[model samples]
Target chain A: MGSITLRAVSKTFGSTTVLRDINLVIQEGEFVVVVGPSGCGKSTLLRIVAGLERATSGHTLLDDRPIDNMPPYHRNIGMVFQNYALYPHMTVYDNLAFGMSAHKVPKKEIQTRIGQVAELLELQTLLRAKPSTLSGGQRQRVAVGRALVRQPHAFLMDEPLSNLDALLRERMRVELRRLHERLRIPTLYVTHDQTEAMTLADKLAVMRAGEVLQVGTPKTVYQQPATVFVAKFLGSPPMNLVRVESRTRGAMNPVGGAEEAVAMPAWIQEGWEDATDENGTIWCGFRPESVMKRRGPGGLEIPITVEAVETLGPRCHVHGSWGGQPITLTAEDGAMWTRGAVMRVAVPWDQVHWFHGRTERRIEPRPARLETLETGGAG
Target chain B: MSNRLSRLVPATAETPVRSAKPSHPEKHWRLPTDWREMLIGYGLILPSFWVFLVFYYGPAFFLFYIAFFHWNIFASQSQFVGLHNFAILFHQPVFWLSLFNTAYYVVLVVPVTTLLALALALLLRESAGLRGGGVTRALVFLPHVTPVVATSIIWVWIFNPNFGLANALLRVLHLPALNWLASTHWALPSVMIYTVWHSVGLYTVLFLAGLATIPRHVLEAAQMDGARGWLAFRRILWPLMGPITFFVVILVSINTMQTFSQIYTLTGGPHGGAGGPAFATTTDSLLIYQTAFLYLHFSLASAMSVVLFGLILALTLVQKLIADRFVFYR
Candidate 1:
């Protein structure tokens, strides 16, 4: 009953299309976080599901019933706004009770629900206090409490913790996850913060330019990004992407400038074993954490000149240029790497991601069986 | 003496002098550096204070002083009348009629103007995103900027009983035409209609400004809470608007109780000469003018002025008390 589905949804404001065709499904009791940069239509998509914005074309189904035509209140879904939007005139208890009272829930039931939500959110002592008198964290709790009191079929949060300080945002991120677990209500949360998207989502959706680029579990999306944009967006210090020309069966050269060839690891070579010709130019990507300083010949090695180093607690980021291309690699003991120093870094073939330069999409090798069938059909 | 001298003279780097004066255990007496700033602040306000003394407060005090005297401009000697003027005002039926008429006018105009202005402001706000909204707002506010007397004279024609626009509209609707402004029953009501029309625009503008200050998300949250339309207005908007609504009520009440020009100009001429049709439109302010200038009973007018001032002060204080208890400033 808690499942929500959006099918072929698109929205436009005047001449500008804010959201292209978007399809998503939130299974019952699942926590889905849509992550993207600003102006990416993530908030707009959440509003569409919350009934605050109407889709230009498509249907929104709740529990398999079309609910797009229903008003926000009739949909019985709770939404926490970015600003909290707590009534300044009302006390915390009254703010929590307002929605229930609007729905004409019995007075005793409203009281019971408010009591439970207050205890759950640790707002017992703050119920009679007005929102103006409460601190930001307290106000945030009251906002969540207000949404929680409805015992809603689903919850929608739009950057709820973006206003809080970093320390408090981290704590509230954990609290929000725990609250979702306890309530077990299907929730769709939207934020631009990568850490929140990575930690809080049962399923993550990465979006850009009015379209969802990829959706999967956090691990899968991080490990196997569907596009170059997804790969570049999800990780910190971001993934290093360099364009290269495949001139040999098991080696690649930096696209236009450097003449040095890089050896392809065994797994990639085995996947391309049946190919008659090398695929032209493609994008090679590897996470900063996957790059290791090496003096050996097993993996792809590129000589780089270090420009700067950033210390991040247990590790450091070495920013450098390899074959005229800027790259960053995470390393232990930042003291060992100095500015203007030249070093060799290597990445294993499995850790390397391949994307077509023209399409900017990941290039997965065709299975040998399928390759043979295509060859047979051509003959 | 040497310590005082050293304190007076500026010390250079080569002669950095330390005070040899013993520190007092008791309070020190010295002029503060900001004393000149305080003087300049007072000097800046002196002109405005002088103007208030000459125009507003001075006249009000003079009127209070004269309320106890039988003063005449031409007579060389004047006699102290004490409470006699007040006693005479109480016994006069015209004074009581004027008080009743003022009360009636206030009771009717204040609530009606406030409600109508709020409704119109809501409509304008809803239509603000649509085309021609700016023009419509200007049209609504245009009446407020036009001279009141000029508009009242024009309204005089609109409310004319015979061959007038008011009756013409009634006839077009197939409704029976009745004498307005000429009839005693309709004279006061006709003046009220004119007052509300002329002043509702200003209140509407104030309300529009108040509506603008409210955050849009609060209303959206209410909509999500199943409170729409009337329910939303009552529970969300009205309570949030407490401060502005209180201000509008007080302002409208004070203005309505003192209505004079529209009543004087609209109901003037052949039919009993303003506050006319057998004194149906004579409010307290109009009666005060008639008592002072027409009959040259300056003492009686002064006494009436004191009573009016007292009522306005008391009403404002009561509203302030209520506001402190109920109005939410933020």
Candidate 2:
């Protein structure tokens, strides 16, 4: 099985810990995206799984066998780096043939593998060209082909498309997804782009501060992030966090005490603890999309003064000040890429996420969401 | 406007009284022609030219001028013998032998030293980013900065007849210790060892700097594409370091051609022997000095100096022309 599992993995560089206690299980043929902001250890985690880095503690398992001490070559894992890492000295064919050659595959089999990979990546015509001569997209494809030629246990990509131009990155994302669909191989992809994490991942892990904050399907992580950090990290105009004290019957409750009754998230009703959280005091998070442009049932409409409008093609972003703080919400299917406009935005209460901000734990849930966080709060 | 100008300019009004400066183009800026700028330019250049005229061209041109006649450092009894001095110098077997020996010295030293230097440079350059690269680099470059005479003395000890460092090490290894400085068979090789040691440092530093110029991603990418140690080195590092290596080769070759301080200090004293035991260490410059200073064959030595200069020039130019085809710069 190509299923990969990381158990309590931690990595440190000198005194600074880069990744900490990462525990994850990727099922066979699962497509996973380890998404985080830059320097959040998403790439480091991917590198560790690829055996490019040695985990300082704990272990990684492929089919339940620990691989803490494995070298990259012995791990039978193919990695595509952000820069593509295509050998400038070698032709595309040679680049693709290299890994297989190192594995001591027969020359004929190597040729067959290269041919198949090239055909798959549509790089057959450029085999004789050196990496320096190829365009960015072509070079990236060759790098992928180099990995693909091995047909190893899994593929590890470290922000592999971040170097490409915007249009090309979008195009390659679809191509990569299509390839994954066809190959159906377990792949661990790292990217800081939430859009990429949402579009390409069969399962997504949102990481921050060298820790996995939440792991789930795209819909789950987007709607019900486990922590304030995840909530702030994963969205485009990231989820707005409003510090609201508990209120009972529209009156402020005693300081640091639970309110009698109020409309709250489903997970908050479950218990005092989940593995990631035991604290009762929580930070509420709601995405811009969840809080929509129109009024809907059980949705809270927050009043604000629009600061600016960012029109990104089919949709518009209404950035404004809510309760004397900046809050940006997506205007649903509106035509306003214009600047300086005011509007009231509504947040569907069922779609809001609540979490222990201190422990970075999911204390609230979204039962109405399409999917839920990895603890299986909702499906 | 007219009232104020009328009083002072009344005298000059007949000659068209305005500012007596030419002004035509609005777009043009004024260029400074002050003597200070000229003085500053002259000041900037004076030191180099002064040294060049006095030390470099002065000796080179004066050597030729003095070669036509004969001039001794101490004697007023100078004589002009036309080309007869060169004729005599050419006829003398010892002078010719010294020249031939010097040529042999260059032939033996240049290719061998260049290959060894380039090989060492490549190794040092490749491992420059690895652990202990700094220590290794410092050790390699130590000989270049150390005084040549000091190193020559150290090598002299190494090349001693029986109890020297080289023979002692050989004895420790249970290998036969051949007489180094004394044996005509080993004398040239002994000097070459010192020369290689002295020159490898400069080449290594040049190559390490050259290695820095090579983009690291290119090498890393090469590694990713499965180009391992040797292939990465031969194809990528070799091609990239060519210009620096060639420049160093030319420089070290010129330095080797005129290698004098060590030879003079180690082998040119009283009973210091003339170019080792049997003229094996008699390089071109040492031979030139023996003729000019010791024997006062100034004209002949000057002629020999011209030949050596020509040899150095020719070799350097040849290396440059050949290296041009292979040097990669980007």
Candidate 3:
């Protein structure tokens, strides 16, 4: 078990920076996943940690020992790649034994360690089978077993489940969680999948455009995203960002929303004065589930026309337009909504967020239900 | 009367005849007119087929047919000797000696060339994507695309006796460079050196292609497992290089057996040259040429051709049989 810390690490390929100022710590026995879009340098950061790619400038320390100069083997790092990368010619037994043999471990101990790992991965029955004959899932298990036999400092995984189908990916995600808990080794996993990050990571570093935008627990990052990019990136049917302009403190017109005018609540209005500019550009960001389906206290009912509806068993996505700008809200039932039907879109004042005109940082007016953010606000 | 019965009697009586008629329309049953265009397409390929029939199969069967008969350009009459030509070939000591020599050459060269090629390939593949890789590759490949005739001539000059640059360098270095081509002991080994040198480039490229297919992550994983250099090469690299080795072995064997041009150019056999004051430099092809064309012993030459063919076929089959044991497609 080890802790990995990167201090001011940055990597550049040619003129373009692949990663910038990436300072993160993976605590001992903690599983941290770095999540981002492709080209966002998530995998590059992982490679840097694995010693496969060197950082252009930075200090990376494992257990307080600088490992940036160490070769991969010398660093005692084990990496699980997206492709299993199992030696095709070797049987599962030899695949597990390869590292031990390379290190010149005794033959008897090699056999014993391989036997232990095979049993741990439940790969004993597959020990004699060649990699070519194994299914994708089994190959993945073998890859994990190969990593496990080394008992390295930490396991660095790069979207290791991306090759598996949906069902297997899910199964493997659970397997990985169980394995992490059982081993209690510090792990740094890289993935672009948000749900995987949410479920598997104790900490998430949300990266975008070569910079990490936010880093926190999954709940903290999702609930209080540091920037619009993080908020929009983390949620599916992503958070809706409606641009609004500040006019006379609280009252502002929606940017390019239909001519229908609406006023910000008195609390939202004060927050807007400090948060937004008079120039036509502040955005109100809200999640799909946060939008109210019915009129309630602290809600503003605005006119919206129903254009389309997608029924998913427990909840249906009601896709429509508000003031002629497209809006989608998750409705929790199958309601009879005719084509071109106009209805009230009640947005609870407490749930709506205000942001700066240029910078998309969330501006708070002390919403009633967010106890955590409120307490965090005190801090 | 039967036709009348077909109509007047129960219609079921003609059921078998009715079943025999075309079920679908005859126009549909015939292939489309597009077939005429297809035939025209195939007509375009006829020239290549004609070339193969004339140049490939033509010589193939003709060589065997001539092997059973004796023909001499200087003689007034060509005679059919049947198996007697073969009998005369079996009695020659040079026949067995040359066969033994050629097999020795193959044994010495093939394994060395294959191992060298694999090592060069691993080196080249590692340098892939690195700066200066293109220049490195070009340098490695220069000897291959260099005209073999020019290179062989260069080797001949380098192996020259007495006043030649080869022995002069040996004197300067205090190492004996035996007059290479002039010494019976050095000639065969010298030729193999040239052969191995030329063969390395082609096999190296083949191995490079094989190595490129090995996933980069696999190498990294091996590295993480503490496997590097020779251990990695032995465990991962060599086993996966099986297919390339198999291909190189077969190709080298075939080329070694058919190596006439270089040997002919270098030694010119005992009749044309001294053959190093012994017959050490004479290859099987050289002996056959001398017997059939030099001495008018066409029967003996014909018999030698059959033996050479047999040797080539046997080696090729043995390579295939051995290859099936180690080559892993996956």
Highest TM-score: give the candidate number.
3
> Ten-residue segment with the worst summed lDDT in candidate 1 chain A?
A271-280
TM-score of chain B of 1: 0.88
Per-model DockQ = 0.52, 0.21, 0.56
Model 2 TM-score, 2 decimals: 0.80
Instruction: Give the per-residue lDDT of model 2 (tens digit) for B101-156.
Output: 77777788877877776677778866866999889988888888989888787887
Worst 10 residues of 3 chain A by lDDT: A370-379
Off by over 4 Å in 2: A1-3, A25-28, A62-67, A74-76, A97-130, A150-152, A247-281, A311-313, A332-345, A365-379, B1-43, B61-137, B212-232, B235-244, B270-272
**Arranged by TM-score, best first:** 3, 1, 2
Alpha carbon lDDT of residue A327, candidate 1?
91
> What fraction of correct interface contacts does each candidate retain?
0.57, 0.16, 0.76
lDDT of 1 by residue, A115-149 (tens): 99988999999999999999888989998888888
Q: How many residue pairs clash in each candidate?
A: 0, 1, 0
lDDT of each: 0.86, 0.74, 0.80
Better of 1 and 2 by TM-score: 1
lDDT of 1 by residue, B1-330 (tens): 353434335863323432444467256665553674466567868999999999999988989988999888679878898999999999999899999889888889999999999999999999998999999999988888888789988988898778789999999999988778888888898888888889999999999999999998888888777788787898899999898899899999888877887887887833437787898888899999888877899999999999998988898899899999999888
Please say which candidate is ahead in DockQ: 2 or 3. Answer: 3
Residue A334 displacement (Å), model 2: 6.2
